[model samples]
Target: MNLNPDQITNYANTFIKVLIDYSPKLISAFIILFAGLYIIRLINRFIRSIMVKRNLDPTLTRFLADILLWVLRVVLFVSFISKLGIETSSFVAILGAMGLAVGLSLQGSLSNFAGGMLIILFKPFQVGNTIEAQGVTGTVCEIQIFVTKLITANNQTIFIPNGSLSNGNIINYSLQNFRRADLTIAISYETDIKKVKEIITAVLANNPKVLKIPAAEVSVKNLTDSAIQLAVRPWATNEDFWGVYADTLENCKQAFDAQGIVIQPYVRESSKSSS
Candidate 1:
């Protein structure tokens, strides 16, 4: 119980030395943890502030913000562990292995997510627009990271994967200010070409929905063994596409019949069959 002065001094020095040696490690770990959590909060605030200030779309902004926050969290966690004297190589290897397994299992989901990202970035189509994609035609109702929702003219809801949507061709009818209504009518060669053209033009002129600025054109596009093919193209708003298409075809037939312009068979028979 009675220690010499030198022994007491030695004990104090030893304790101070241990504290000094471990202080840096403890401080470093604390800083790393604090920085990681702080960074998450800061990044989230930054995203929200910027997005609200700019009035960006809520869905897109939230999606991007979530991704950014997760990335920051992972990076900060790694840094924090490294400060705690954990070997990063082994941790990294484990993370890589798990990521690979999850990635493989979610291959389709990943593809869809990537496709959705492209769609948001490129904006090939938007909600409430009529679009034809993946051999299906409908109005786009919603676009999500996993799928695209479409509502058909008949009010049918269809879900299409983002991958199929991005990879396949899409015909967006709503992007353009105007759309063309094309009708093909074939007439017998013996019928007066001049008369047929006149009848078709008259029908287009009578249609109030047709736009005159673009100047509709009616011309003989081809002459087949059975008939003379005429391509009548008229300009109209995209909303009126189906309406104008239906009207033009019906009107052309009525008008041409009254003017004695004959129509040819849709499919021609062989000469031997006819004989």
Candidate 2:
């Protein structure tokens, strides 16, 4: 426990000498790190602006930008580490091992990511498109890196993993400029088929929503045990598809009532009353 002023002085001088020797390198490394970060941000923004101007797919643009930004950040981090005189070979090896572990654990996520990439590249369906897939029907809201968001007709939000969506059959109702509304209504067996068709045709002709080019038609689709099934096929713009569908059914029902055509009840009534 004896105090040594000479030893303390020697330690202080040695510390100061080491600091002075590395000060320039430390300062240079800090400057480079800051400059690199700033440049990276600038590049990210520049790339985003370019993609926006080119009208590139938003999903793919955002995904690629994120990837580029992260890769640049990782490279900059490695550079900063190397500047501190730390060997990066071991650091990179550690990162690789960690990445492999994460990749293995997130196999499904990786599959979804690949599927998302395929969706963006193939252009199967885009945002705002009404699609039916995986036993669900909805309008595509957003296509993210791993999942596709859909807004159902009943105002429900659905998130479908890209892996499943990409592999399954996707019915893109909005792919065409126009969509056909397929409807079936059962009428009494005694109802005249020819007159019913005429009445439905007239109703369709009056409705402004129905596309005139395709010309809506009504025909006997099937003869069920209870009633005759009439098929109503009408075309309308993709945007007006749902509106036309609902309107057509309503108008047809009113027309049938006015024309004295009997629309049979779905559930048949028993002739004998319960005691």
Candidate 3:
């Protein structure tokens, strides 16, 4: 089929009219797009500097900055499309629906991610810190987006989901400069209570790891049928807690042996009757 000259002229006029009507909007959209991108970069840089000044974790800072960048880009894209005379309400609604679906499918993972954000923000525990959480005691090795890695004393690597870890009780042993070591020593009921306390106190004082300012405490915690439970409390630097605890126990035992302090064994009443 061949078009008439009139038909060709009509088509050219229509094309020019459309271009004339849309050129301003197209130029504006391009300008806004570039300007928005520059502004987003500035905002991201400002935020990163703030996070750095506040001493936030590097990994967390990068993750948050990337997220913000993408969100801003998405908003800019929507505006650009709207300026091009395209309907955007349906587009936004579609995006919202897709987000809801994805969020629901990844509910647990999203929860863990949120928890990780909270942990990084609040810093209840950090990498290399010894913490007891979720019934596990270990040094935190890594903090990730959804989980925390811990290395136990026995060289086991444990992965704890951040959701529960953030919500549960956390005992950070390394947070404080000093830690108190509580030890229990049992002695025969016939032993001298005053002498026992004096011996334990001397043992703690002699240990270099024990702190002198707060002083050590040794007192009868409980009395059983055969023995008295003595609570030996000592303050030591966090790094020296285990050393002080072990040395104190061993030193106290040696002192007791030298002083002829016998530790009574528990004999059950039923066993005594049978014998």
Where model 1 places Cα greater than 4 Å from the true spot, the runs are: 1-46, 55-58, 72-93, 270-275
Q: Any idea what lDDT model 1 has?
A: 0.88
List, in order, the clash count of every candidate structure: 0, 0, 0
Candidate 2: tens digits of C-alpha lDDT, residues 121-154: 9989999999999999999999998999999999
Tens-digit lDDT string for candidate 1 (94-175): 9999999999999999999999988887889987889999988999889988899999889999999999899999999998
Query: What is the C-alpha local distance difference test score of candidate 3?
Result: 0.92
Query: Candidate 1 vs candidate 2: which has greater lDDT?
Result: 2
Score every model by TM-score: 0.73, 0.90, 0.79
State each model's CA lDDT, in order.
0.88, 0.91, 0.92
Q: How high is the lDDT of residue 43 in model 3?
A: 99
Q: Where does model 3 exceed 4 Å of error? A: 1-39, 57-60, 83-85, 265-275
TM-score order, best first, reads 2, 3, 1
Clashing pairs in 3: none
Q: What is the lDDT of candidate 2?
A: 0.91
In candidate 3, what residue range of length 10 has the lowest lDDT sum? Answer: 266-275
Better of 1 and 3 by TM-score: 3
lDDT score of residue 212 within candidate 3: 96
